[model samples]
Target chain A: MSTDALTLDRLARMQTAVVLGYDPKFPAARRERFEDLGLLPDTTVQRLHTAPLGDPIAFSIRETVLCLRREDARRIFVKSVLP
Target chain B: MSAASLIAEEEKLATVALVGSPNCGKTTLFNAMTGMNQKVGNYPGVTVEEKDGLLVRGGRKARILDLPGLYGFSAMSPDEAIAREIIEGKSAFERRPDAVLFILDGSALHRSLGLLATVLQEGLPTAVALTMVDEITARGGRLDTLKLSRALGVPVFGVVGHKGTGVAEVLDAAVDAQSWPRPVVAAPLESAVARAAWSDTVLQECYREPKKENRLSRRIDEFVLHPVMGPVIFLLVMGFLFQAIFTWAGPLMDLMSGACSGFGAWIESWAPAGLPRDLVVHGVVEGVGGVLVFLPQIMILFFLINLLEAVGYMARAAFLADRLMGFVGLQGRSFVALLSCHACAVPGIMATRSIPSESDRLKTMLVAPFMVCSARLPVYTLLIAAFVPERAFWGPLGIQGLILFGLYLFGAVTAFTASWVLSKTLVKGSLLPFYMELPPYRWPTFRNVFLSMWHRAKIFVSRAGRVILPASMLLWVLLAFPRAQADPGVPAAVAQSRQLQQSFAGRIGRFVEPVFAPAGFDWRINIGVIASLAAREVVISTLAQIYGVESEDETGLVDMLKKARDPETGRPLMDFPTAMALIAFFVFALQCISTLAIMRRETETWKWPAFAFGYMGVMAWIAAVAAYQILSRLSV
Candidate 1:
């Protein structure tokens, strides 16, 4: 298969992906779901909050900077292409 | 693929392997699918735990293999190697799985994609189970399952394993999936940079999300993960936990103690006076009850720890302690294993499988038993209540409670010190960086908590039956045999003491008294100590039997012990210094046969367990002697 045909697979194969942020109202079960999924939120990524408004969260996963809304970031599947 | 071809594939693929990264809700999903139909064993030639369960759906049955969580196909540790071998059809135990259920975390797609890619590359008939979908949508994010499925050229089903949401649909799709095309050999990404570039491209195309931050989690982490306040909070939490273990379990422990005594009295009343009656009433009932009384404490400890784990504060505690652990040349991950030792060292040692480094795992295993496990609770409770006064230190903290807390603290300190020494001498290694994900905090489900507590209680009770029962019977034989002639003038307690001294255990205790003399132990204490080697709590039962007290009457035994005098000096046998020395000894002693046997099993060798026994034995003797000498001098 061409690399394009394997684009999704290749992304899945990346060693690291940044977690941008998560929703404040994120259910404990859902957070536990992530833990169950082996993505330990605290240990896996560094969370950085912006001053005054920590609305958009930033996390570095292997040099990838992901900026996502708190609500939408709970289940982020990012694979950064940066070397 | 045509339906006929799909049918052929499904026929050959009778087994489904649930593969995912560690903590990916894979086990939970497996439980949902298999329910109670699972068999757990060790893989051939390795101690890695293997779980196999039956997956029954639509009148069709397939075997499901729950492999240990793996990061990739490249196996680094024994656990990962087992996972890799089974996935590659190289396992001696079973053939390659027919289909792969690739579990992916819906919330953290980027991290999981790498493993998913590897699974797809293997060319198995694979289906994606998008777990944590509820968490995703709950966070105001939606996953385009169909779009993502079409994009990846495979079936993707969203599932919430615990809630049974969309799980049946996922299982149906997985069972019906046709053979997937194997990836043609392509030039592998030669550098880390190339791999990252590839992952970036694939994620950008398939996954869609709203730009947002998790503000609530951040606000909580600010305090929870704070440096100074974090440790303070952790200490306060632990202090409360230990206090609760004592105070909360008091009523239950008392009830168990009372019930055992009543049962023993009832048995004694009906049974004829002979070896059989003595064995049934004193040996079996007393031994089992002595251990059973501590069951409430064990259950409560596990229940509280599990609640904390469910709440996700354990990870943060580990994070804060990482630096201190590093200073001791151990990983922060060892914190959980050590914490778990409070309930039982066996599980705590088993939990070391998560420590990737070999040296670190071994060190953690060695020190785990040093933590004051529930097995020691009975001994501590007995000793502290007898020796320490009931007066309050500051407000509600009783002196006895403070001493109990001190013993726990002493265990933890000694364990850390031992770890440092071992890291420096025996198992030298650099500290590995801590990489752990702190799950979002939530309320613990009552079902989950209750089940966990129930499982621990079952294990403790079963062990009492399996290991303690036989050992108790053996001890009874040793103490009851070589029957002494009954003299009318001899008091019953004195005759029983004479009978015990002439028995095999008594002989052994006498033979060892010279060695134990420095620690203030006489022949009777020596016999209790020897019997305790079978299990620590047996010391209490053995002492009761030696003193001729009814097996159920603990207070009577305490009164006897208080009046016990050394024939040579006429001083009380259990003086304040002697009690302190005995407490010190139990604190450091490796007296649990079960713990040693488990260590042997986990390490796959007798050498380490033997070493643990030898070192701890020596340490216990020295600590006991020093405690006795120092305290005696102060009393004089």
Candidate 2:
């Protein structure tokens, strides 16, 4: 596969992943970017689980569990997955 | 070079901007690089904090501008916009940076490199500082910095910011690369997908990660984040926090109180019997002493909160709180602002800058002052200790401790209610989605925690000296002057009371007494309330002066208040019902002048602060009246 095609596939998969939360490190800007994506559905809710640090969060997107950092979530193009 | 020439050269140092994603340990790196040679100010026309430090490498000196953390150059929040403008050389006050220290988190390299791609496109002489390499390696991940640097066409240094590892090399590289050509990516990633792909490719080449999940962190998080148990654990943690603030700090508070009293006694004995004696004893020592006694509580509170934040539990707490905050029409992000208000409303209001929505920011600021800040600790401690029984409840919890917790909870509930009301009526906005990074839990360093506590203590004490000292002196003058003609037959206590009634503060208190009458406040309480408008803790010191006791002798004030009578009814002045009413009143009152001033500055208008003060004042009065009336009837 071409690099662009692979990139597009990876991006598509990421876009399907539910956004758990933004990394608190760069809170405001990352949050703004996440909101701009407009990926979260009204029915979507935060799923919390135990991690060494505290509760690592996940978002319920359909039935898929895509555990990723908030920064990663920001890179996923929401427009591709929307509607 | 001559000394004059060297000084001149240092004055005109080149600029280096340290740019990074938030939570990438950029600040720790900046602190390690700059050490004590740093100055903090605000960006031009913006309240966002600007930190600059002098980095002297060999004979070269550069001013390092620690720009606010940003994800990309796209201006979103004020922090990002300000940073973007500075980096782009569009800032009116700052010139373009001569070099850029681009920091990336080693554990999250793929995501971080996305930002690096943007930074590289800016064409500045950039160097990469990869942070958290230790954590990455501990988690069975490997990063080849050399290869990554070669690929990016920039120098990459592996550094642990907190441990000061590999920092000097990074600084040297940053300073020496001044003449280096502006960085150009071999292939620019134009679209978002391309950028993600580019970052992923780089990560694939340079990094490796262990396949297994982190068991320890996961096990701990399971219990901490349980839906039903999470809130229960949070409440228990918070309850213990407040209780410890009272329990652990009692001895230190007594010691501080004793020292103040001893110092005042020395001053009284040394000075001749006159206005100078009264002024030195009552004004400076007594006034500042009352505040100093509460320093231990304030320090302990800050220390605990800082530890919680450093341990990364605060973010989880915010995530848990997001749902409830949503019900109040507020973003979970406001939780940070409210938490900051626990220390001081000035910083709390300032922290609202992190909330992206203008309406959310304003609403958060409006209700933030209602949080029981450290300033209220002195008053609450005094009132609770004086009025409430000290008997233990259910083995360990003292009634005083529980009452203290109740006061804090009361303030929080009132703040949330106020936010909901204001959001519905004045500042209507949609609740922003909660997105908070739960940071890795780490043991909080003693150095960091101590430094934080010291900083807070210094601010509190300085405020006492600067604002409270002068206010106390003014109160002393108002209370001490217009000495009544003494009838040689009158007793000293009676004579003092009569003299106080004739004084300026006493006269003003009488004038305002009728307004507070329904709230069960007398002329003496009126004096304390009026004086406390400058700062909440002033009420404690003002009451000491009104009761003719040294402010440090809090026990003496309590004893005096116990015996004190209403001039008309001859009943005890500070009854249980009245004390409860006073506590309720203070829970809602916007008493801090500094909070008001900061609100004006943050909102850039007097309209919000004025509205906050008027509404809070009215709410406090009504609450106080209801508590007094209801409790008095119940007691009867």
Candidate 3:
């Protein structure tokens, strides 16, 4: 709800952000999968690569890189980390 | 934690399951632990591959299972569900493992450990095998396994699977799992946030983060996944793969066929000409030869595919093609299987295993046979050369080339359209989330690549061969039985023709002629169509034999077919319309029995294969009839 709130998909490439949490809009099962995949609140995420056609993008979080469809990424909220 | 429990567990081959997410080096550890002592089975209902192998030490042995990779126990796909079911003892195919070897990718701790937390709560005896330690350390990360082990109250072994380091220790520790320490307090079961907090607390002292993402991978992706260059590169890679299978494998395949025929000739040269000799040459040798010829192409295809998968290029290829393939209600992996189908549908069907979703896999497998495969080329070539004139069309391209291109295009269009229809009607499912892990690229290990190729070859020979060879024998019997009496002073070739004309297959072909009359085929073409079930190219030879020409004399047979008259009307047998009809039917029809046999092997049920045959049969009939009727009417 803050002015600085950003959905992960909207975050620019290579921009580092701290996970604020997922939007409550995601169903319970998908939300749990998000957490189980290490996207917990306060986790650091940096947008890495976008697929050629630009739908699925890869992000580096917790020393691992995961590819997320742009649709799924639009649901996760994050905040920019101060340099 | 008693010695008696350990002794009793050893009496039976205690089972240990390797559990981890995809791209976590779990298979590498499985190969390292079990060496060549591995067998692939399927989970009870789902056809996902279950890799079973053995771990031996001193005097004891135990079965080690490589369950399909899992991100969590949420069961997103059939593969994930099978992994969950087997681990929970809910699977009827496999008992609950006596112990679990949890492979934790050291480089992907946040991801692997998060999953690990949920797995530990399964209440099974567990040991952690830390993999990707080298990847971590190379990237300026460090982990103290001893400290992490103490925190979790479980034994942890650091393993570099490709190098065979610490793999034995994990198994040794897993075998005595009864004595392994249990956690004092389990991971939080209430919520995902609570579990993440639990993992963070445990990793606070032991785990360190890699300084940054892999630079080499990023540099490669710059070109490989570029908006413009990415598609260009993918096309080049696929085009090159297509050419290699058709061109490079051609000679080797010829050599295999040549050897079978040469051996058959050598046996006939010495032995008395009799039924036994003919059966040995045609029934056994030729039947086995058909199956064996696929080995080189299979080996090459798997070798390249394994290399791509091992080097992590396949995931990127899938990422690149996802949107385009999605238009057909399938994902990018289906494209790979369909591409491979151009060479042959046997390996193409087998490659569908790479597809993650069950419905997608079945859809890909069913429609792949429609792709213009190499076997159909012979029929197309003979027909087009005879019927389609060689007049120039667009630029230097001849009309013949254009028609051939049209046939290939038609095949591809039908394959995609069929899959779209299937996605709506038969194997219906929304396009699932395209979840793929683009692992950091590494050199593909030769041992792993060779082992994978070997496993596929074995499966083809054992599973497909069991059905195809016996079926080939039956086809030969139908074409060879109830021999016509040899008339004195008659040429052997003509006498052979008489025998074939009245043989069981010939009778059936005539019986079915009325059914095919609408499609412009008579009994001779019907016989060729039926004989094609052995392999599509057999149609050429069957026609050659029907005209009493040597089966090897293709040109002679072509001339005969072009001039011959229909028995009743004395009209030319094959015309432009019939050629159109034949090509139309071959494009849509599933003619090869071997394809069905392999489909049976992959799906593990007769239902889907039967449905594929029946539906394709109807499609072929309608297309053939329509093409013939329209062309004949327009010319009139």
**Most DockQ-accurate candidate:** 3
lDDT of 3 by residue, B218-337 (tens): 789878988789989999999988888888889999999999999999989998988999999999999999899999888888888888999889988988888778778788888888
How do the predictions measure up, each by TM-score? 0.76, 0.76, 0.95
Residues B517-615, model 2: lDDT tens digits: 998999888878877876788787666555555436778767766676766778777888898888888988998766775676666667998999999
Cα error of candidate 3 at position B13, Å? 2.1
Q: Point out the higher-scoring one by lDDT: 1 or 2.
A: 2
- Against the true structure, whose TM-score is highest? 3
How many steric overlaps does candidate 3 have?
A: 0
For model 1, residues B395-464, the per-residue Cα lDDT tens digits are 9898999999999999999999999999889997633212455555554555556665665566456633
All models, RMSD in angstroms: 9.4, 7.3, 3.3
> What's the lDDT for all of these models?
0.68, 0.69, 0.83
CAPRI-style grade of the A/B interface in model 1: incorrect
Ranked by lDDT, the better of candidates 1 and 3 is 3
Candidate 1 chain B weakest ten by summed lDDT: B1-10
Give candidate 2 regions above 4 Å deviation.
A1-32, A35-83, B1-10, B41-47, B186-190, B213-215, B290-295, B330-365, B368-409, B427-433, B443-465, B482-491, B517-524, B532-584, B592-611, B625-635
Q: After superposition, how far is residue B69 of candidate 2 from its true place, in Å?
A: 1.9
